[model samples]
Target: MTALRALLLTVAVTASLSACNRRDREPAADAPLPAAEAPAEITPADAAAPMNFATTSPYAAVKLTLPNALKAQTDLHARLYADEVRLLRQFVEGAQADRSEAGDDPSIPPYEKTITLTAAAETGKLVSLRRDMSEYSGGAHPNTTARGVLWDKALKQVIGSGQLFRRGADMSLLDQALCAAVNTARARRVPGAPPLTLAGGGEWTCPRAAATPFVLAPGTVDGKAGGLTFLIDPYKVGPYAEGSYAVTVPLTTFRTLLAGAYADEFAGQPAN
Candidate 1:
């Protein structure tokens, strides 16, 4: 999702709620980083499992687009080609590194990925993409501070109704697809690949970071390679008067897909 999509969805979901914000629920005064907790590993066994929330059914009224708060993370998915392997490697390594860095410390929340796929009895294609936000965003907030309020508000909006379709692909298959996309990108891309349609598109939004921040440089590579690619003007004017970007990854891979670029501050996820 481009920053514009993130912003639109954030505005849409957050408009009724509130402008938000986090740390590991960062501890203050005399507090020490807690022990290292287990890593957040998304496994097939875990995804096949049942979920505690309600599933999507043909009876569903509206397609629940993720609220900005929760959708933010899901949106991290860069617009890589369908078969970029190195990109996928970075994604997995990122998961472990991010969680491990947080550690088992008392201040950090334990990391784990709980993927629930509920096929609506009516429209089997539309599946509810629910997770244990309790884990992903646990420590991301703290006692109802101003920041906490914003973060919590965002997650609440996205958790329930967000829909997903792995192209009829299950958890394992999706994982494989991710790896495949990353590999394909590596084989096709030369070192120092120039900014292409999907390069700078790896942008994100952080209302709290800056009024509007550019996450990366004018040239940044979206680490995936897919068969179908969408091209856009790298410097196209955006919602915040910034720019727009494109990607190769299928639209289904992400939710709340937007069409905008950024100021270059909200680049791809940080290096762990």
Candidate 2:
């Protein structure tokens, strides 16, 4: 019954690379451009990729579960699947190497990495995957990290913050929004719960940087594409006892600053 902590993990931006591209255009002075439009049809399938079975290693140390749609016959999907395999393999090999080196150290117990799919859904044209990964090496505690994977099925490439956002956007405002969300969540905690303290029990606090940690939550026609959910690890924004916090902001709050398919798909959709 380990607590799931949302870590600021990194996922490679190789899937659906081409789909995030935008065509160049110049508008005339005093001329109004056409308003953005949502897709003609907005079916559940249109919003997300198909489901898939889970995969694991014979050693029972490494496991991988992904969308069935991600394992399609297309080259892009193949590459995506391969990438997943490679990442799991790395964890397996690293663990094995650690065990080999720990032969004389009775205090170090061998452990394996378990990657479980916790959430999978679609937002606009993007398919998002959230995984809870845990591995115990020779340390005081096991390493558990919450990770995110964002893919563009149309472009057959994975994406990251850069692909999801436009240039020259007001990043500081976005950071402030995240801080406010986290503080608000903290306020809702049960009475007497451990409070989230500053980094040093002083004025030091979470920074309003461009690379604020976050994960994309599921989005439906009813809910639409709200602002991306910001994820802060237990010790990152507060004490370890405070655990982790995830807070959501409305897309309308920063819609004008977004770009690419993420922006286009939610252009005309109402936020919740």
Candidate 3:
């Protein structure tokens, strides 16, 4: 998804009002980074297991696409994907109603909307699910945002940051590390871009202990534990133009902060 896709989820209803001053939708100058590196396909062993879902939707006009590994598994994840599809359809229907109520104008073009949810990473008992939405409904530009879910199969639950990290650990250090990685990534992606600081200034503000948002990144090598991947939404750290930022804090950096079975998985030998 592009930067514009970052705003789509929130703008579903207000697109009609914003469309009045809309400019021609331009392609994003930079592409949003992928949440993680995905395996080309589900392995033969995983594929041997049966998985099934209604791929096409008559109500939402949406399709449920899942990674082969995720599809092959018959578990809570399958139901999660189904629920995602249902929510997406609701968003689309809401957006369409807004458009209809706003009335038509020759100057305003038809809306083109897309919502996609994908599994960014699946290793052992953990899976990362990412949702990307992009919609253009008579606005100066489209809106987009990518959201993620960390699913723990053994626990049979969605893992939150608080549960993942040990209590009394230094969250400030985690915040600092995330900002540094974001600064480095920004400089590389935009040559000569001004650097960001911990303070609220420049491209974005750093997230604090209470508001650190993150997703899991795929390891540099397949099936390895890459560690926690931070998600910096537009306006959360920077202007909407910066889109969303994803910074991975390697497992090695804060192994001590991890807790429970997931922590054991993070500390274990890298998967080959």
The best-first sequence of candidates by lDDT reads 3, 2, 1
Error of 1 at 31 (Å): 35
Candidate 2 scores a C-alpha RMSD against the true structure in Å of 13.6
**Model 2: ten consecutive residues of lowest lDDT:** 25-34
User: 1-272 in candidate 3: lDDT tens per residue?
Assistant: 21112212223333333444544443221212222222223334433433333332222233334555565444543444444444455545654565566654445555554545566667777877665555555555675555666667775555656667787778777777777888787777666867777787564566663355455666655664677766665555555666667777777677777766666556432222
After superposition, which runs of candidate 2 have C-alpha atoms over 4 Å from their true positions? 1-60, 68-77, 104-108, 190-204, 207-209, 219-223, 267-272
* Steric clashes per prediction: 40, 9, 14
Spell out the clash pairs found in candidate 2.
14-158, 15-157, 15-158, 16-156, 16-157, 16-158, 17-157, 51-68, 52-68
- Candidate 3 vs. true structure, TM-score: 0.69
Q: For each candidate, what is the lDDT?
A: 0.23, 0.48, 0.54
State residue 255's C-alpha deviation in candidate 3, in Å.
1.1
Question: How far off is residue 217 in model 3, in Å?
Answer: 2.7
How would the candidate models be sorted by TM-score, starting from the highest?
3, 2, 1
Cα error of candidate 2 at position 113, Å: 0.8
Candidate closer to the true structure by lDDT (higher is better), 1 or 3: 3
